[model samples]
Target: MEIYRDSKLILEINDKDVNLQVFNEKISMPEFNNVCKLNPRVKITDFIALKKLLNLDSTEKTKIGELKEIYELDISKDEMVAYLKIYLTNSEIDRDVDKVKTDIISFLNSKNILEGINHELLNSDIPSCKKFVVATGKAPISGENAKLVYYKLSERKVKEGTDGNMDFYDVKLIDNVEKDDWIGEKIPPTLGINGKTLFGKIVEPKPGKDAQLKYEKKSVYENPENGNYVLRAKFAGAVKFDGKKIGVDNHLVIHGDVDYSTGNVDFDGYVTIKGTVADLFSVEATKDITIEGKMGIGAVKFIKSRDGSVSISGGVNGKNTTKISAKRDVYLKYVNETSVVAGGDIHISQYSMDSYLEGKKIILSPKNGRIIGGQVKADHKIITGSIGNKFEKKTVVNVKGFERVMIKHELDSIEIILKETIGKANKLKRQLEIFESNKSRLEEKALNTFRALIINYDNIMDEIARTNIKLDHLEDMLKTRGDGEIKIVNGVYPKTVLEIKNLQRKVNDLMSCSFYVKDNELHLYD
Candidate 1:
């Protein structure tokens, strides 16, 4: 029989179950409760089911006061988490909260979910009618792979100096290693830790992989200073790394030109090139470098030695594009439009035309070796066939060499700068004088302009004073040191500038002569 009837819903109670039918989709809870309030025997044991049926156009039945059927427990597929859902109950039903909590705990314990359980949720006043995360498991972490650390050379192709010149000699294509130098060290991998699950099962973490250290056993040795895996060089050589292996190369020989096929030659030890070095290709070494083949009318990029000498059997036609630097002497057959810097003497079999040469002493074949249209500097003496050509091509010979020439150039640059600075200061001073009487009557922009002129003039004056002091110092240095001599075996033509210390004399008439400094005077003798 129907106990409560409304326009949208009907509720009936029987011995087996309580039935509910929702005629309308929108039904109120107060309407159902009003019917229950009139009959004390009718009670809501499952408020969740009754509330769900009130908003649906269907019929559903549920047992009164059946607490066990209202609970739901679920475990995720991975078993890493567990969820518990409890349906709503009514105050009118006789029930025990602790008994329900005890049943849930017992059920979780039966499933072996003791680890990572949320105890606070089980002990607190848990809100019903919704699912809650009751337990969580930890995830396994991955270990980092092993790595190698070692000394690495700079990868920059050109290093710029403070003087705004590119230092090609400083670039190292191969990393140079000394005896007992550290090559690299292999760091061991870490052992991974195990994880846990909601069921107290062990989850293994991923282990790191070890990387193999490949090297030549004869050229490299394991260091025993500490209990670490470190490799060191057995002798001095260049470091060679070929993706899978590493070793030290003492002597390297190139059978062909240093072109696209060979790239660049950079070795720690001696290097010998059987053929010519192609244009835009560089060869650098710590020891001596020898180029046996003739340079085939092309410019060589650069050739450098850190602690040894350089020798080119074939002549070099650099075309103003080549540079050779060596710590010791340099021997060349003939050079044109090239720049050579040597710590010791430079010996040339033929002539050097339109090339920059700097060394302790520059010597050429006295019979026919000529220097034309270029700057040549030597600290000791310059022995050449001729100073300049008969056509009066400009050729500058500095007997006092590198330091003196650099100082003179710096001083000349400073003089030009001083002249410009003084001129600007004078112009600004005149502009400031014009605005002196009308300072207060000027506009904001005009006043700013007047103030800027005064500041710029003061700054220029300060710069001029500093430059004068520097000029005095350089002039003193130039006067005290100019003792080298120049011996021209052939003839010194016009447009040839001879510099001894700081004194410069221009050659006008063609004359075979030798110039020397005595008693602060440059004397020329035939």
Candidate 2:
């Protein structure tokens, strides 16, 4: 430390401590000549000396007392500031005008000011607050209250009892009130991350640790304009942040663009897409999603929920589901879902028999697209956009591009041809003789296969006969009608009838031409 006459620090140091190889001999007290820039590490002697110099009780007055006497000193009752003179000489109470105001209001309230006042934003275009008990200007106040009231009212409401402009509003100029004795005011609470001040209690965030509150989450104490009021976050270790951390459980907003390409993001929280989510990403969350920008080109969007799913605007062929199945709704611009239920009403815009739809009730959009597959079962109602169907229930379909769907038979010729192909393919030893050339059982097996083939052929012949009878009936009906139009029901198109008949006839003809085979028979069914 140093002391100066004209302009220099009157330096003082323990001679022994000052000169030593291990001491590093590197220390300067800015208070030298009335200037003391701080060093992070204060030597033990410095700490005691400085404390004594600034403490409420100092024995042999230090230069600080001399400095205060030489320079007009108006240090507020801030022990912290007194502890370090650097700030005391530079900053003034006027700089904390809002704090002064809050102290006065709080003091007035505790002391029972004429009337109670609700604190709000200090600069609002329209008054966000009003004095219902007394007309404006009736209470003892000044121009600042007039100017500050406007803001208090215009700013949005904060958690139950916090002021807007600052933890405390400016009180340096309030008439008939003490600036330092507000009912619940204390030294302006220490401002930390997000400018949050703390000094009382801790609250469990709604979503628990890291839960982001949509609104200001702190609870404030509002008292009648009287005693001191102070706001402080007592917990020193709690991490405070800036801007807003959004999420169902916890949300985050990146000021810059985000590039996320994880296999899946599963959270028991809410997610927000401020920038484009470039690819089809999967997310499983307990709550909802809000997409601020369009999902980039060529990406599919899918959301999974355990409770309920909500998307501000969404997509097609893409499905969003939730385990809470009931009361879940999917709103989209252009999309398809077999079922949607809101308050128990299920709605389907377009659906195919092959595509399954199951719900408590359904409402179909007036618009309808082609449906090639699945079952539609709803307990309530079904609406339609436009009915496009082949009128046949075709399974295993993707109903994508082909307009005017039709029932295309999926032939499983394996079962039908199995018996015939295998039997005709079996080995034969009949020419040698039943007893000498072949084993008795093997001969029987061959004859049995051939006989079964004959029966199968006969069955085809019968089918042909039946088909002809039907054809004749159709012809007779056409003749009977003599000019009326034919009605097709259940997709029994004329072509379908023709296909069956043609296939049946061919089978009959093939059966008519018998054949015998040797070893290595084909077991088509197996």
Candidate 3:
């Protein structure tokens, strides 16, 4: 059987015999014959025959020696890597590097390692008697997971002062969006590319995992233009995180102090100020308002909520400088010289010192809450831990039968205005009467002035009629009465005036009692 063949010689191995035939007598043929004799697998028994054949261009096969073993080829268990080892001596394997490479390729083909052959390394010099990594397998690429890509809103940059310094407080912390504005989109996962091994075995890749976009349907909706993965705002407002979902809220938030940086916030939504409001500034909102920081004297001209409530965690140190109003309720840590009016209730956690508080009900914390040296009025009831201090600060508490006093005061004021309107109308009528008497004898300009006077008279009469209707409505409200009370838990010291409805009780002695109206008179229950 033929073991190896080349252009110049043919090497054969028979039963216990090695043969070599040199068909061409070229300059390198003798060298090739010598290399063939040097193969350790074949021990030369007739070196003279091989030399005679190389010298004589003989094509006839001749026996030279017997065989031992062949070169070794190793493949990894996974068949991902392959290595070849030439076990012959260095001098025996010394030949043209190209021919060696050809022999290696032939061996690899026989061993079934046809893929990923390292041709570059094979093209260079290879060592003998040492394992050489001749092939490598390709690795599969993993797919990327799904992700969300948010659209860019405003840059959170601050304004530069005249000296070129950045105004840190002016940086925008909230992202605002208009109705139908795109917010973000989910990017789908991808399928990865496959790979192969040294044995040409196929490798499957891992597909990426998909994800859903989190959002609220009320404030955010899927954009029809880009399918369900894309999101858009449903209203014009601030963008915020509603729990775990991203949403657009009808609420404005001030992350820092509300000063020149955020000019007097006047939003038509819920407002939350994490910091203090500066002096002379005002905050007005259509919904609830919350102030996390303290309100100093003159800090704000007014903090008002048109249709919701107000809560101040750090209390008010207004010093009679700010007016706070809410349609529903007002919650405060403490009140110091501030005037607050709420249509629902005023809840104070601590002392209310020299502050004018008016609400449907005034509630102070029963633990240590106190009211000292201020007018407190509630339409329903007033509950406090203490009423007056030891020094007799003369605090006044009024529970006036479900806004009866408030309605009476409004009615009185409107009656006074009505009286003025009637008087103005009578005066205008007398002036018009004098003009009508002289109109026939007056010139064109005089007649025009007379006509204007008559119209003014009619307008004043209409004003009087409207004022009378408003007064009548307030008077009717005063007639619709309800129960009212004032309860003092700890003590009502001397000089404290407690009133219920039209009755009054002066507490000259320290007493803890509930004052209510009974039998058309004020009664105290201890």
C-alpha positional error of residue 360 in candidate 2 after TM-score superposition, expressed in Å? 3.3
List the candidate numbers ranked by TM-score, top first.
3, 1, 2
- Candidate 1 lDDT over 310-363, as tens digits, reads 878777899899999999778777789999999877877677899999997787
Q: What is the lDDT of every predicted structure here?
A: 0.74, 0.29, 0.75
TM-score, model 2 to reference: 0.25
Candidate 1 ranges with C-alpha deviation above 4 Å: 1-71, 89-107, 118-128, 167-176, 222-228, 242-244, 251-526
RMSD of each: 26.6, 39.0, 28.1
lDDT of 2 by residue, 317-368 (tens): 4332211122344332233432323323233223333334444333343323
Model with the higher TM-score, candidate 1 or 3: 3
Model 2 misplacement above 4 A: 1-249, 252-263, 274-280, 291-302, 312-314, 318-327, 336-355, 367-372, 390-526
What shift in Å separates residue 420 of candidate 3 from its native position after superposition?
A: 46
In model 1, what is the error at residue 348, expressed in angstroms?
A: 21
**Highest-scoring model, lDDT:** 3
TM-score of 1: 0.40
